[model samples]
Target chain A: MPQRQGSLDQAPTGVPLTIVRLDESDLSLKLMEMGCLPGEKLEILHRASGGDPLAIKVMEYVLGLRAREAAAVWVSWGDTPLRNLWNSQEP
Target chain B: MSLQRIFLAGNPNSGKSTLFNALTGLHHKTANFPGVTVESLQTEIELRSTGKVVLVDLPGTYSLYPQSQDEWVACQALVQAASEGIPTVVVVVVDASNLNRSLLLIHQIQELGLSMQVVLNKCDRVANPGLKGVVQWFENEMKIKALVCDARKGQGLNEVSKAFGQRLAEARSGAVSTVPGPWAASWNEVFGQGLETQNLGNEVIRAQHSAETVERYRRINQSLKTCPLHETKAKAALPNGPDRLLLHPVGGILVFVAVMALMFQALFAWASYPMDFIENMMLWAGENLRQFLEPRYPAMSHLVTKGLMPGIGGVLVFVPQIFLLFLFLVLLEESGYMARVSYLMDRNLKRIGLNGKSIVPMLGGFACAVPAIAATRNIVSWKERLSTIMILPLMSCSARLPVYALLIQFAVPEGYILGIFSLQGLTMMGLYLMGVVAAVLSALVMKFWIREKGPSYFMLEIPAYQWPVSRNLWQVPLRYCLSFVQGAGKVIVVVSLLLWFLASFGPDHKMSETLTGQATPPVLEKSYAGVLGKALEPVIMPLGFDWKIGIALVTSFAAREVFVGTMATIYGLEGDPNQDGTQLRLKERMQKDTVGGSKEPLFNRATVWSLLVFYAFALQCMSTVAATKQETRSWKWPLIQLLYLSALAYLASLAVYQWSL
Candidate 1:
């Protein structure tokens, strides 16, 4: 189900979804490449060691996204237990 | 693929990115827009069952007739694509609500006579009944396909896609592109006779317009307002009443101070616990692993505990600080408060012959200088961009957190400030304030130094306050943290390895031997790093830095935190009481360590502050240097930056040392 997590920039983090659209070049381009899409499953892998380059495993490879860009990637994360547990855990 | 390139063009804030995201899906990344100076949004998408098209998001601009670098970037992309004779279709995205304003650009695109379509973006925002005429007028006047699309809501997206394929097919069939207006044709005739030949403004004018654009401008005045349409608008409607008090000259200064204070407090207090935890964990891990290996691998054990532990520990300490600073920034930005700061600063900045936009990168640089340099790209003039780049090193990056943190702990402590607040926080505040002052003064100097004429009037889009998007706010900080760790982390690792090797062995004797001969504190100075510190004595004498401090400086070239690591490496860090994460150990070593015939503190207050000043201003990171080189497309800029920063550092430190005495 496509549920609103709060803002236009974000949806609940879960199974990777296909990239539906990219909004602006300056900000959104940075977000689009961070792995939110129309038909991809993105599991929140973990943050970069510094907790900024938010890491998500997608396309079978780990991707790093800046928080600004990550907010734009409307996602619906898969209900895998390990990924869900890590994503829900408080920073 | 049938060899077609779709160009996406629109004004800034026309929701072009949203449409690009929609069209390209997940199959694209940013690269410079071919050989030109702009970034074109290029991605692959299916057009038909067996056909594919390359979508290029052209840099958004108000008009094809260029003024700024961004506009030049867009215009150049068009010229190159047109010259290439590539099967190209231009997608002109216009904000639907401001039809006339956005259509000014679409008309210019039509003048190019290229196969094109106008995407009336943000149709969702325009509830006006005039929408039908607006779309009708666009279609009737320009004759390109018009799609009333909401890039955000996926409204009219398929129509946009259909227009893309349909336009390109028309181009392939050899249709002559549209022509310019009757008035632009007359304006060109007037300008051609008036050309002074010395002015580039005329050359740009000549190049951008079609044979009859002068007629286009003339005809524009007949129906639409001839002047630039309302210049621009707020992304989310702007508030009518100005918050003049918030942006007044004096109030802006005080506000800047308070903001600086809040940042320093967050840097110092909120980030400390995590820093302490990270430092302790690294120290503990190294110490325990050494014991596990024991006497059999004495050499290996020493390497891990001393060299590796401190090096990595030094870098990780700033991770918390980076997050905290980013958090503050994300808040300020999402709230639309930065525009106010920019607007206020612009009034003052314009005096130094620069735009207010320059302040954006300068303010943002405090978090990290690399992106600050990248931010300079938005400034149009080469002179302004270069000046911004030249002064950015002085902004004081988060790397200096270690040096400043140490200084505050030792030299300045929390106390009565006019019997009111923490003096230490004030001093910390002063250091950041010093950096800002240094940046402005340097820009002023460069203003005089570079003979290029100043920029044209500064125009800005002040986005209005809206409820801070919680998703955007959270994502912003996370993004910065990731970038810092990945970029800074790689450099930190490499530098640590080099430092580990340099500090591990000595000439003709193991590092432990040299340490043992002179070390009075058993655990304090008998490590490889300690011996290395003693060896550094002669070289750093001129600057009043001893070998220990010299090692710290060298290690910090990799990153500022490594200074602390080199200290941890040289001094015994694992509960060795003398060096137990206190300022005392460094001071004792600085004052009593025998580098000369008579003992003296390696650094007095003046020298320490000067060293603090040096860290505050210099771009010492190997990562930043590499990043600078990448950004400027040459070694010339980064090299010049290093030379000037080094000279400034040496001169500042020298003066501080001698004057203090």
Candidate 2:
């Protein structure tokens, strides 16, 4: 998983970033049900209706996801970028 | 060999729902949490290989003493859990965003002598500024274990649950304990009794109270110094004043006007299309069912056209509007704007002598009174909470929307009024404003009546306005629609069928003579229901109601929305005037009542206006009454509300009728 700008042109495509956002309150309870958590690895493969929703693969399913939920998901480029994020929050 | 019960309780809006949804993951179980109608939603999970289990997710509460209805319910649940001989665990959810303030409640719960754990909720908002140091410092000083969790995100879930779980087990096994003779004993004393621990319910409740719940809350209360993160916590000093310029006496009302204007504009703009789609769908279903049913099928003739179509159609009309209302409310609530609105109202609300805390319940009153009553729990004083509960129903709920819509359509002229105002919009606003004003005035009067002073504290956290959480926002409409489909659908269907049966065949009408039976449709002139309607026509004459409208009024007692269905079902028939009058001929049958010897429409302006006024004031829903009784835990209050509303409805309708006449 090398880095690439997440192009919306093809199926099972790749993106270098994680989630940007989830619709406020909608993805909180069903975190896995949606996808990208803050600092998690995710990619958009293909999108329908000009990216109102996109099919993104996460934890083995190409789940249909809303752009709003995807937006709250903060991510970084590189498949292994999450190495920096897993640092336990300083107690 | 022992099972432990953990009760997660905190003030409302402290991420309680998120935590519940977190632990349970729909893997949870629900029953009425013991001692309150409010659900005791619990999920039991076993730590594999340890053979140890724990329950999570209870109700939210501020104080364990039970000042408000929700608080009372939460307290009772703990009581029952203690009595059950299961080691009870309490997790006090503290809003990290509002630490010192919420800690006041934490201290109280701690003082109550119960085993507890503290959750520093909304920890994601903690920016790494010196606030982190503050959190660490508080933890060092408080001598309690504190875990920071963004409950909304499942952050710290495994760690916190496991840690708190281990602590609870330790407390239960007599390894760690705090001082307690059962905290709710104070409530028992307040009720003029000593804690009779042996009473099964009390025993179960007290047993769970085992000193640990107290230590846990006390430990957490002193541990978490909640300072706003650098980015999330920045603020400038507000303009110095008793009130902002926006809330100036005259200027404030203008802002209120503008806010209401936006709400009305949205009511039409946002909901109109969805409404049309629903109506069209209903019409489509009706026509399809009509064509599908053969003319010769038994019960099929009246069934498709009258029995089924109208019943379902009536409820479907409200669905789009309900969804739209929830959508707007969710958006407003999620955006942090609902808090601002509540903040804006406090000054004026206080002038009218209401506790500022009452604003939460009053605003919530707009949605549904039952929850509005439940929402009153946050008000610290029982006097304010009780009075807030008493006046909450005056605010129109979603259930009342149909009655208002129909009455507005029939009575208020669609044309411009006062040369410039849209009369319907203005009327809707005015009616809603009336509820607010009435609630305020009622509170003011009660202030004099009860003569109690309220604690005034301005301590509040302005949570840095972040974009609203998406999960909580979208969950609203999905949950609303699901519940509405289940709850309102079943009731409407049953009522529809019952009404069809009632209006279809009379006690004495011959088959061929009835409208549905006869090709030319003979007389309903002799049916039992028809005779009763005609006889009662004189009583309703002054108010402009006729037999059909009277029938609708009678049927609508089951719930307010059934009024529309009753009218649709009865008038849909083409049966006769006397005997089979309950049939489709009802619309025509009602046209010529000739009240006061005039050839005017039987349901004229005066009568329609009176009916509108009546609906605005009436306590017509059996379900709301049942909900109120359940919420309040007594017949006296609901009975009083019913009597007052009925009297108010009748008097107002009479005045409208008499003045018009």
Candidate 3:
């Protein structure tokens, strides 16, 4: 399955997306620990009116993330089969 | 027998503190970890089987791999305790509804090879029918006993305590096994994969950690498949009704202002009763004690009535405001609105080198800066936290209110502008606005001045709205207020005593006796304080301050509210005349006084405005300085703060005096 890749900051609200990878940075560990791992499914739930900090739903919880942190996480959004995405990326 | 230790560890917002409070039941004391500023709570609990054991509540961390100082402290304590081979039991409190994320930390602790017991907290929030299977899976596959309890309701807490007793007993007998759980195989896979990327760079190490997280989640997802536990997702979203308005751009600001207005209204309106009561009671006690002891033991009477009682009273007067401020903050935080405030204010705050989390501390500064400085602990980023602490004292705290009131009454004539606003009231508001503008400009300056220690991230957790726990409402405020009294209260008392001694006697006894025989002014003029004031007069003369105002300024360093009392005593009035008639009489006396024996009034517009500007900007409160030192754990920042604020105060007051002239 083919997918369109984008950072979480640009991802549309209420649309499901799969995390592709986290940019190598100091905050990656914190993001991963908060369940923002690759192959995890999440959706942008809401955005602040000024649009810096965003609320995203992941692992049955809503996490508030700033735009800078959201840019670190690369995600893919499409009408692709969900199960095939992780299996295809497995080492 | 020596007491065994049971260390409670968990992620933030996991109800770990709630569980600790329920287990210890108001018998815990907060103390800093050795060589670190992070505070942890410790208490003794008696189990039926085992004797009393120490229960230590570690600071919350998302993982054993440390990011912030708090996480470092938590991880270091566990590893050190383990390496020492102390008889310890680690009770991992996991949020039941967020089991997968919680297990990530559990797996990290497992790799440490410590005796661990799992307690699933907030079980009432998890709506999974396979919750039973989730506990069973922990027992069967993980080889770790799992206990379920709703810590908020105090359910299954006794059984949790019983498990702690059993674990401690086993730990004492050296029979507590650190067996490798089922997660060991996956951990081996993670480390084995990490070996290939070793020594590449710092980024590689970060990448390896990320891989480990991915692997742990993969394992958790695979293992929980048979049990099929799904956390109910219906309650996860912020309800569309309230959140719509709360997160709105314009609406959010309006709501924030309204909330802040209500808090301050409640603070000043309600706290005034207790503050007045404390002031009047202290005056009565001091007056009676002075009359009783002045005749028999003059020295003892002066020390107790003048030094000790007033010092204690000054510290006690701020308690009502501090308690109310903390109560409002705790309520906002526990109900989940505090996070939204940070979310909404992040953009505007970022422009000044701070973030949304700075709003709470900034608002808390208006009540008092001691607890407000301590409140900076919630800010994880060092630069932002330091910046927030730097500008906080500039917010025109309640201590400066009296100084501003007296000055405004003297400086501004009794008249309205246009038709509605009183001239005096507008002047008071202008002083407050000046403090705010100064704070904003200072923060802007500090933004470029302070270098970032690392990349700052705002990874806040927005939990669902829920009613705050009834017990936490009082306990949290009570804990903070007690800490304030212990930390800042000491400085106020010492400064008070030192000021009393400075004002009581002079170096030349014969000259002091000759001066004292005439009146209070002559006695005060000859005292050491009066000598020091005369010495300072030349320096402050450019700002329109005379020797007497200099004395009041020097004495008010203990606290700004002491300015009125110092003025009263300097004018031959015996006690603090806080009442209306006495204040009016003092005002009349001040109105008659002249500048340098000239016909011009001393409390003229220029001098009053200058004094108001000085009080608004000066770092006069010794308690705030002490608290800043304690919170930053260094003298460097506090020293920088005092220097910068004093410089600002001097320049600003000079400008006001010259411009008014």
Best model per lDDT: 3
For residues B89-108, write the lDDT of model 2, one tens digit per residue.
67777766545445545555
Question: What tens-digit string does per-residue lDDT give for candidate 1 at B382-476?
Answer: 67777788888787777777778766665575677577556766677778878888778878887788765533333444434544434434444
Residue B359 Cα positional deviation in candidate 2, in Å, after optimal superposition:
3.1
Recovered native contacts in candidate 3, as a fraction?
0.72
Order the candidates by TM-score, highest first: 3, 2, 1
Candidate 3 structure, TM-score to reference:
0.83
Docking class of 1: incorrect
TM-score of chain B taken alone, every candidate: 0.74, 0.75, 0.82
Return the TM-score for each candidate structure. 0.67, 0.68, 0.83
Off by over 4 Å in 2: A1-91, B1-6, B11-13, B21-69, B87-89, B97-118, B129-147, B152-253, B331-353, B380-383, B412-423, B435-466, B510-532, B575-599, B631-633
Error of 3 at B52 (Å): 4.7
Candidate 3 global CA lDDT score: 0.74
Top candidate (DockQ)? 3
The CA lDDT of each predicted structure is 0.59, 0.56, 0.74
**Best of the two (1, 3) by lDDT:** 3
Q: Model 3: per-residue lDDT, tens digit, B45-81?
A: 8888887888888877887666654565576677666
Model 1 per-residue lDDT at B204 = 40
